[model samples]
Target: MSSTSKPSSSENIVAQKFDRCLADLIVKSGVGFSAGVIASVILFRRRAWPVALGTGFGAGMAYADCDRSFNPARIPGTRIIPASELKKDGSS
Candidate 1:
């Protein structure tokens, strides 16, 4: 007899929530960065140095936002185990 089990309702709900969060983050960050770049280019064409610089900075910040959103390692409260904690046999 096979004993394969289906996922619980709670598990499916949690997975859906995670997927939605990821999708929202990607869309928001991507739109923010694209808008910044576009504004920067427009300001640059108008010879507005301060506005151009501000938009460029915003674009960079948006890029970082996207990176952190998708990569769990970039999340805060995550600890990095020191190399000294490793065993001489190359195992953690």
Candidate 2:
């Protein structure tokens, strides 16, 4: 007999989803940070603070956007809107 309890199928599915979301967040943040760094270097040389600030901001935005899309949660009185929520009838 096994000593450890095996996870159910539903639990496994949830875990897999969580893992996928985490991977997406990491990839998106990395790409965004790299792009920001390159842009900062091209736009402003010798600006260490700007480069760091831009990288952080870009990465944060990328992560938030990915989260919003992947795990959408309806929030009241929030200005931020997901792209998928937009309707063709011109109604929010």
- Tell me the TM-score of each prediction against the true structure: 0.40, 0.49
Clashing pairs in 1: none
Write one digit per residue (lDDT tens) for candidate 1, span 12-91: 86676667666655665566656656766775564455454555565566566656655658888998676776665486
Residue clash pairs of candidate 2? none
lDDT of 2 by residue, 10-37 (tens): 7776777778667766776676667667
Give the lDDT of residue 15 in candidate 1: 74
* Weakest lDDT window of 10 consecutive positions for candidate 1: 46-55
Best by TM-score: 2
**Pairing residues by index, what is the TM-score of model 2?**
0.49
The lDDT, on a scale of 0 to 1, for candidate 1 is 0.63
Whole-model lDDT per candidate: 0.63, 0.66
Worst 10 residues of 2 by lDDT: 69-78
* RMSD versus native structure for model 2: 10.6
